[model samples]
Target: MKPLSPDVFDAAQALWLQIRMFAKGMLLPWRLNQLLAIAALFLIAHFAAKPIGHWLTTWLRKRQGWTKWKLRLGILIQQRVRVILFALLAWILVAVMRELTWPSRSQLIALAASIATAWAAIGFVTRIIRTRLLRRLVRWFAWIFATLYFLDFLTVAENLLDSLALSFGEFRLSALTVIKAVVVTVVMIVAARLFSRFVTRKLAKNSDIAPEVQILISKVLQGVLITLAILIGVKAAGFDLTGFTVFTGALGVGLGFGLQKVISNLMSGFIILMDKSIKPGDVISIGDTFGWIEELGARYTSVVTRDGREYLVPNEDLVTGQVVNWSHTNDFVRLDLFFGASYRDDPHEVTKIAINASLSVKRVLAQRTPVCWITGFGERSVEYILRFWISDPTAGITNVKGQVYMAIWDAFKKNGVELPYPQMEVRMLRANRDEENAPHFQMTTSLKD
Candidate 1:
């Protein structure tokens, strides 16, 4: 309300001039015309893209030769057809504008078109990447670079990224350097995995190569390739490896203390693979855990029990501890069942019946047959031992044993063979002098009564 100060008046006048200049720039004939053209192009594209995309997609689906390729292409069209059509139209419009020699607007329109095309391309690529985190990272990187390029500041941004660095002695690390290292490492790792799988398949197809040998080769190649990739990435990042000699020495000492069990397990895994002591599908028993080996990993062996439980056993345990490998040489296993019959029953008949019972079970090996013999003469019964062979201990030993026992019960019941129990006969004795004095003491007691 009062008279404004001199400084305030000057500042207000400057602000008013800036507002007028901004309005004037917006009102320029060429700028306004370019904006209108962009609007018009966007509207046309928006309306035309859907119908065109639908028609193209339908046409592609009709011409289906390469079944696998066509299926993949059909998916792409179904999801991104509109974006693809719009991008194409924008590019065509940009080209036409350039041909007309509209220098001021052509570059801007081309940049916009390029951005739309790049976005569509990135979207398609990210869909193929599969991993959510990796796809998001790629999307962010693509959009950032695209924006920088559109703004004509790509070189400046790169320079700034490179300039922001930290130096460690002769080694310098910058944002650009780190980015390059990460990209190179990721690419190398992916390539190594693919190559390893290809080599593994080839090795697996070779009839001469054992499965264990194939596994060993694949694992070794994978380790070497990954290590090589890391080294190459570090070198590309401009890191001087010679400077890390002391660091590595210290790291080794630290690892020795902290990762003794891990290193032992890793070495033990190599020993197991080399010796072929424990392999996949091999039935093994260690301590109380008995199961077939599902997988032999670097640190642990996956063992799945009959109860549908999987245990991750340390590799070192298999190397150092006593492990009973049922299928080490062959799947054949011998099981013994002990029973005794009443002394009154015919031992010969018992033995024959036991043999038939053992043969009755399906899992019992018929070629080897079964044997029954007298093991011991017990106090109450004659102990007989029934021995049978089974080819698949992995299927289970206890269940087969139980089945054979049930068969024995059925055979014994049908044959009228009696299973025996313990019986004791007790007798009491008196001293000789007590026996002699008994008649004299009995006469004296009768007179006293």
Candidate 2:
């Protein structure tokens, strides 16, 4: 090779001198200047970056007319930005180390490692920022990012790894293969998130469904997006989906045995959703278990009862059992109060009083119009049936009944319509002498058998 330029030689010599100085400082038993210098640099960067990030974030929020949540969100973003900036500065210091250590392959390798580590750090911070954007947006971001970084770090470390492999007369692998896999995986995840957000936003814009339903649908869409993303990531990881047909048999066997209940419930849940028979917020009664439908999972439905207990009913039960949807077509529910009045009271008058009593209740729906009828004639009383409807079922049936019955009690007392008790008439025979004497009178009329 031609002799290097004078400038290059001088630069090389300077780098060599810095490396020698650094090594000597490390070897010195009591030298503290190098350590203090490094610590001072880190502290300066940390304090300076944090305050600057905070001021910048505050200014941004003021300009954007941020809400309390948004301001808090911005503060979190600023913190993350500060950390990332500090990390980048640290990496730049390592690159400076490589420059001062002369042009050696190991120095270049260390520089590359530092760059890879810094890149992973940036990605981790970005994921955290994204997760914190919405309220409690799931804290799984750190785990996922860590896994991704490990995979990427493994890929980037392949060069030194393959050299070791070559020393053992083994096969060599390129770092590019591993790096490409990580890049493609990251791209897939980002794409999935974007697509999911777009679909969820679109679904939320539809006003027909309840808010909970919209949120549930959005979650389902996100799950589907993630599944698709996984498939794409697998493809990017150098796996050919078409070549993996042999795994189908294994998958089928797993589904047949291990995942039977999961598959069954999932299918049943889909059916329930499509039929629109059971939905979020519906007040459904399944056997003795009655509650508002809080969530519909793949295998079970969560019902939040009035007592604040949540019941998880299997999806199959919801489809197979008798479900009383109190608010099926409408929120109107009718309650019947059966009362029996004294036989001396006129049947027509009893019916009129019952009707008026139902009308007096505030919860009674005027549009439905309360109805009363003389349902039956008993030995001691005439039975009256009062049927009335109310609009809100989630407020409960008992409360409505209480109001109507209270009104009825008041009306009956005012109208002098006494609610009769159960009564019976009985005849008793006297002793044998009296029975024989009574029978003697009838003996002439009829002969005993």
Candidate 3:
């Protein structure tokens, strides 16, 4: 084997000396007592934690008028009671031992207390992070770092990480830098998203703002905040932002070609939102699809139809194709009903009956006043058209039309108006009864009621 490098040799020698010193220290009576005392304190804390945790949970439950924040804090503290108690007790023992005996005798207890303290504090603080995997990883990372610092091995770790590096003309990147970059990036992005969401929710509650405007504001704010966060995080982690211009340009070019439709839809979505032509809860008809607008997404708009099926219509279609917004200005919709009555019936009496029948329907707008007029005279009867208004179009138009038809039928039946129908008459000429099977026949029609 080649001779060890100078740095490697030095590190090995330092580690050997530390091991020897640790072995020597353990042989002393005071060090052994110190170790035993820490072990006993940890044991006592573990056994006492169960009862303390139970009691704390009960106490919090019994308390009245406590804020949710305070209750949550108490629960978090209760979960780490063992570590917290051990840290406190160990420190007190360490202080007393130092006062009564040599300070060196309590150093082991101090180290234990220091580690326990870091564990309890970091664990409690990390509990508030919502993502489960991220929270666990952060806790582990913090614990390891704190442990290294307490053991005076943090500098060693830094040197190790720094040794594994790539150097450019003026910039150097090491493992430590990369780790810090990841941590900072995650922190900044999460914080930005949370803040953006909170502001969006507050904006949503304002009745003065239109729905599309609210969405536009939310999208613009989220994009800006995330962009700023990324830049700030990269700079804060000691990376030069100027170095990414060429890469960003190349990425932009690639995205433009690869995501043409996606970008178009996104842009179209923004246009739709800005124009305020369509909004949530608006009943829109595109192509053959008709429904209430559920949500506006970057790529598509969610439309839920009367049949309970949801259609994801592309934003491009909404922008390019013809869209009919039924309730755009107001909820009022006018529907037409056509029917004919016998020629013998008076037109004035028929119009009056039709109007009264339309008014009797529940969905027909009584305030708007339904109207009936003689559209034209049919071949055998008088044709009439009834026009009526409805306030709610989303409840459906077909059912309400059927209701009006039924009302009109009932009203006409209750009165003396006769509905016209065609009557068929057949006259067959047979040479004799023998020709009845293959008879020459004449067909005639009559329009009568």
Candidate 4:
């Protein structure tokens, strides 16, 4: 072989030295003992995790009386404990490995912090997996991981975050930004969860409010929370307050024009709530439409008609127009059924039969006795009115009326009362003939006839 050049020989010697250093780095003089210690720590942590999980699960179950759902609670506690113990084991192992690399307390502490952060990262991932469907929980974990990753200054990820957070003037932050972010994140999460819980409970308990109204409240709560979260995030990012000043006038103007109807409806809804006039389950009549109030939305009301068609009426109309609430004070309604009989039938007997028929209907209120009135006399018949009371007006007055009419038909047939139809009379006179003309039936025949 030809002799190598001097530069190539020097390069080959440097490469050989680097490889030896790498092999030395991998093989620690204390590797066997350190590995044994790590394995022992892991076993200890694993055994400790079980009792810790049991204690936590038992405490939660007994405190909340969750004996029926104990399995679910136990799983939650187990997961948390497993993550914590595993994180501890990982840190101890990392510290042992780092000491084997370079024995120093600072190195060990740094290694432990790095290992703990990695464990937190893994825990974050598992939490996301467990709460895949829960968007809020996922977002919370994401924020927590982001915070931890930022605090991980000893790790390579911390430099990356610092660089990213410094990329733009808007993203740039002082030391104060981290503190603000932490405080705001904590406050926002707690507030949003608490607010949602409170509103849900309130909505479930309130009976007088319509479903639509409760839904509206829920939507408002969600919007408020999201807005607060955004504001907090913005402030935490160290943006100036002056940036939002322009939105104030624009928001006002938008509300004045774009949201005028919405505001009107909202006010009308509040009025409806306070007045206690039109509530869920109340039968109401407005114009030609009549139905039971199904829901009350912020901008409109849902009325379920007797025909089962839902009508969305604007809230402004409810406040302005006359609405007949059948169940306002009580669900009682009095309706009249008019019938006429031939003059030949005894009026007293006809009235008694009609009154008895009204009382015989199942829905008719017996306490409010049915009244029979000799309303008027027509040329062909004597008209009678049967006025009856019913307590279930929400079922519509027609059903009760039909029942009463059917009963009356039966009673009249049994009693031999003659219900009369209209009759008319006609008279004719022959016209007298004058000299010029005469009205007559003419026949083309012989003149002798």
TM-score of model 3 relative to the true fold? 0.67
- Overlapping backbone residue pairs in candidate 3 total 0
lDDT per residue (tens digit) for residues 363-429 in model 1: 9999998999999887677889999999999998889999999999999999999886644444444
Cα shift from native, residue 197, model 3 (Å):
4.9
Which candidate order results from sorting by TM-score in descending order?
Answer: 1, 3, 2, 4
Winner of 1 and 3 under lDDT: 3
Cα displacement (angstroms), candidate 1, residue 348, comes to 3.4
**Total backbone collisions for each predicted model:** 0, 0, 0, 0
- lDDT scores in order: 0.80, 0.67, 0.88, 0.69
Query: What ranking emerges by lDDT with the best candidate at the front?
Result: 3, 1, 4, 2
TM-score of each: 0.70, 0.61, 0.67, 0.51
Question: How close to the true structure is residue 288 of candidate 2, measured as C-alpha lDDT?
Answer: 86
Better of 3 and 4 by TM-score: 3
- What digit string (tens of lDDT, one per residue) describes model 4 on residues 15-49? 55655764575366454454455456557777898
**Two-way lDDT contest, 2 vs 3, winner:** 3
How well does candidate 4 match the true structure, expressed as C-alpha RMSD? 13.9
- Model 4 stretches astray by more than 4 angstroms: 1-194, 202-234, 237-242, 306-309, 376-381, 422-449
lDDT of 2 at 77: 55
> Candidate 2's residue-wise lDDT over 1-449, tens digit each?
75534544554555556557656755553334334544555576677886788787768756665576667666665756644554566556657765775444233233334544454455444543264543123234343444435435433233332333211134233334444555566556667778878876887788887755665676577678777777777677665567557687788897789988877887788778777788888998899887899988767999998889999999988887889998878888887888788877787787887788888878788889888887887766777788888888887777778888888889889999888764443454455773555522211222111
Candidate 2, residue 307: how far the Cα is off, in Å: 5.5
